[model samples]
Target: MSSSRSRRVEYDRFIPFRSAMDMDYARFALTRPSRPQRDGSRESPSSVAYQKLLDDCILKNRSRILAFKTAPEAPASKLPQFDEPIRPQKKQQRRIPKEPERVLVIRGLLDDNVLNLLDWGSNNVLAIGLEDAVYLWDAANESTKLLQPAEDRGPITCIRWSPDCAVLAVAYGNSDLALIDPATGHVVDGMEDENQAPVLSLAWRSNSILTVGRFDGTVVDYDFRKDDMFICFYNGHRRGVCSLKWSGLSGRYLASGGHDKLVHIWDACMPVSRHRPRQRQWLHRISSHTSIVKAVDWCPTRSNLLASGGGCNDHCVKFWNTINGACLNSIDAGSEVCALLWDKNKSELLTSHGSPNNQLTLWNYPSMTRVAEVSGHSSRVLSLAGSPLGGVVASAAADETVRLGLLQHRYTSDPKIELEKWCQMGYNADTF
Candidate 1:
């Protein structure tokens, strides 16, 4: 019986354990001898001690054994519970301001087919030419005074205030161009014989040299200081020259529009200079307008950019690259474009329309998006001039009225306001 018991112990020790619990039980059984199995016999003290040790080991390592067991599945919940309610984020809406402020209006001042009847002087003065009279309106005090010529030539045809604001160039229907002092309204100088046709347009190339466009379709550069003598003549347009503008940015290129539906860009030098004998005075003969091309303005920010607007038959504004003579952009302005003005402080274009619309439109440059429109004139709007302070714009219409309003951008230094203005004009906020 002793031999059989020893063999049983060896067989149990040789058998491989399947789990950690089986290994612990085998260790306890092998460390102590087996107890005798008699009817109603109590367990030996050693067996009881071994059983307690095994229980203690399992109790100490209960977590370790369960870590290797498969985890139980979690029950799914239909709705999630939160400490607070969830809210969706709201999108920001863009805001656009209303029409510009109307500061003042002077009625019964303009009543003709004249194109450039209104201009703002550098001295904060506004000049308006009515039939047989030239009025100087001081914007600072809102005062009006008639500018009496030295001699009664004829009804006033054209009037241009000099860049310095001290002198005014006045043209009469009798083919006479006179330089008058604005303070006294007296003629400082006069020229009559050089231009037989009535001077319809006048632009100062310098303090002494003035460019005159005649009703006979001739463009002449004259030195007003030297007895108003002619320097050179540029002949391109078939009909009368109605608009003349010397580029203030370069002072090297001249843009002139005529009643013949032609827009001519001219170089400032002589038509037949010895160095450039083949190079004529006319640089680019832009025949884009189907009707009269009167409104012409050089971009204040871009030196090589030029903007010109057409008449009733062709209600379009075309932007040109002066260097290469390429039409960069064209916008169909719905109505007859009468005048174009660039904002001095921003990259925006203001256009005055006539006839059907008779409105003033502010546009985003290059994009050609209409920002705002002003409408009050009963007749066609004729001219537009920006204030020297860069905040106000004055518009004249054939309804015999002149209106002053604020610009879309009041201050250039405020970027937040400008960004909001652009977004309101249907532009993406990231564009700027």
Candidate 2:
């Protein structure tokens, strides 16, 4: 009956439920759908409005829905037609030709003597020094003629043709050097030695300058134009100076080897007055050889490159960079390397062997691979010379025979081609 009690009773009556369990029936009745007016009934206003809202959303986002189904692709190039013509690739061929023919041969050269008696002249004439006689064989006509007949002086020790091939420098056992006319076969000039030792080796620097290697281990350069006066004198080898070569490419460097097991590279332009009594104009005193160093030659193409071979005790072919006196390469020749000749047209080297093999080997220089081995001499092969016209090599042996044969040129044809091939394989020139 109080005022607060009357307000609480009025609130409870308006709310109609005192707990959640009392409102469950009303909540279920509200969620239940109304009965349809007929079998095919129309949609309610709220359901119609929700359907219309979905339709509106789809119409507004039509481009976005269609964009996922119709994405653009990358453009493609047009292909060739089926009837188009195709091009063919070209094939490569070998560069070097086949082996050359064996031109000619001469027998009974020195009667089984191991001597440096064979020399090929630029005039296509081959000179052979046999005991007391020196014969000139015309390679073109296949004829032999005596340039110097048997002399009283010691048998011919060495013979070298002048650069012009017009005169011959002959060394006799009587310690005499004679410049003879090849046409007349007569001595035009002569020089007598004081020691009377045999001149074992001879090389012509020019038509006027002649270099002689003596058995007394002396190297003397004589100027024939100046009354055969000695212009330069070098004494370094303790034994006989057996080999001497003036570089044809540089014309300023001279290579000498001796029986003393020494290889001396001399600069001809060096001043002799600057040295002492026993000292000489030797640029490099190379002592790589253990035995007699008899075979020495300058590379025809490389100015500062030199090649030398040791005797039976040391059968090695050594290549030297003469500029710094550095040995570039050393190859065990398996036998005494008696002689070496460089190819004129290719990067090849021909070496003659003695003792066991007695074979003539054609090598790809720098590479040093033996390309061909020719064995015809029954004795020690001593000397080798390349033809001035190229593609031929003449070798002389202790068998008393001179053989002319073809040197293989397969891998030595062109240096540029070899370089290109090496580059493709990741190799350089120094790799050899």
Candidate 3:
């Protein structure tokens, strides 16, 4: 925590943020609204019915946070009586389309033990790992090509783009990790875990540092620039870490959820290794979910706000205000929450689900109201990624198809998008 609020600039003013990982993730996970947003802006209803419901919500939940505002200005002198009083009209928000604008049919989505998530690069490229290969698809033109074909390494477990958008971190089913340049497809660095267990999840802490959560229940941090490489070790989680997300704020908090049905938040400042091993080093050991916690994300704008989703058994999504390890809000999702993404441009959140609905739900934040639902995937929706320009979101499902939904059409040139699905993972099955 900073000493004063004055030190904190407005959100997205990360030109001076200390950690590169914080800046990188904030840019990648957030929606890039082209229109400049004024500080303490207000939301206006576009329709009467919606307005009435919104007003009701405001009245019912008076204590809930709806919008941030500054002090009201001193009132001007009463307007002189006129034929009709002129009033300023509120700008209404553009409604996000309910249907997906484009769809891509590709297979091998159920790659061996891999996380069901994709990453969007600063270059507007979407990285999707098939059975054993990593493919990059350009969202602008819908052209895709194989970036890496690691047949012998086993199926890809996880792929993440570095904060600077220069290198791609790839994890394999064989527990092999590598950093490769997306431009030349050259392996910049590679590492092999002593334990044969594969990496269940991974997140880049910075351009040079990568944290890996393994099936063996080990969390290790590697600094590729160092001669030893493996610089730190974090101990926790009795079971495999299914999801890992480094807080994209100060890079201080590391949140992870796994098969153990527990979510843990660790402080990077607490470097616990074998030599100086400390018990219960985590800042918070959250036991809120009854089942596996696969979906977890740090709020893009709020440093202390974190969201987590539970598995089928629990079917719950919880929001934590990390300040005192207190639960701020919890919602029971009808289906299993497979993934969570926050719409940073607006006070909204998006989640992908499994089982009953396999649909993507858009939610209004603080209010915690369902705004829209997008259905396209025939199976479980595994991954969710937002475009860098902020209009569309890319989702991958077990149905072996990737669908792009137009969230804020006004942020893009048009709402019409075309995607031709083509992946070589099916033919590369032998690679496993």
Give the Cα RMSD of candidate 1: 19.8
By lDDT, is 1 or 3 better? 3
lDDT of 2 by residue, 1-432 (tens): 556654533343333223323244445446646645566778899776654554454232222211213234536645433345435656654343222233234444553322468888999888888777777777566557876554577777788889999788888878888888888888888787656678888888888888888888889887877753777778677878889999988699989998889999988777666546334568999998998887888888898999998888999999999889999999998998888887775677888888787888778889999777778678887788776656667777776666665453343557455334323422111100
Candidate order by decreasing TM-score: 3, 1, 2
Off by over 4 Å in 3: 1-93, 111-117, 271-280, 411-432
Predict model 2's lDDT versus the native.
0.73
lDDT of 2 at 188: 85
lDDT of each: 0.75, 0.73, 0.76
| Candidate 1 residue spans exceeding 4 A from truth | 1-110, 150-152, 269-280, 412-432
Model 1 lDDT per residue over 258-370, tens place? 99999999877535878744435688999979998889999998988999999989999999998889999999999898999988767889998988878888899878898
lDDT of 3 at 302: 93
Q: Which candidate comes out best when scored by TM-score?
A: 3
Residue 290 Cα positional deviation in candidate 2, in Å, after optimal superposition: 0.9
- Model 1's TM-score against the true structure: 0.70
Which order, best to worst by lDDT? 3, 1, 2
Q: What is the per-residue lDDT of model 3 for residues 1-432, given as tens digits with 9 covering 90 to 100?
A: 656555644685324324323343345336434323477665454344454443444233232222234324545545333345546768867776665666666667663223744889888898988776777887666567777656688878788888888988888877888888888898988887656578888888888888888887778888889988876667778988988899887998999998999999988776555667533378888998998888999998999999999988888989997868899999998998888898856778999899887899988898889988888678888888888877578888888888777765455444343221222212311211
The top-ranked prediction according to lDDT is 3
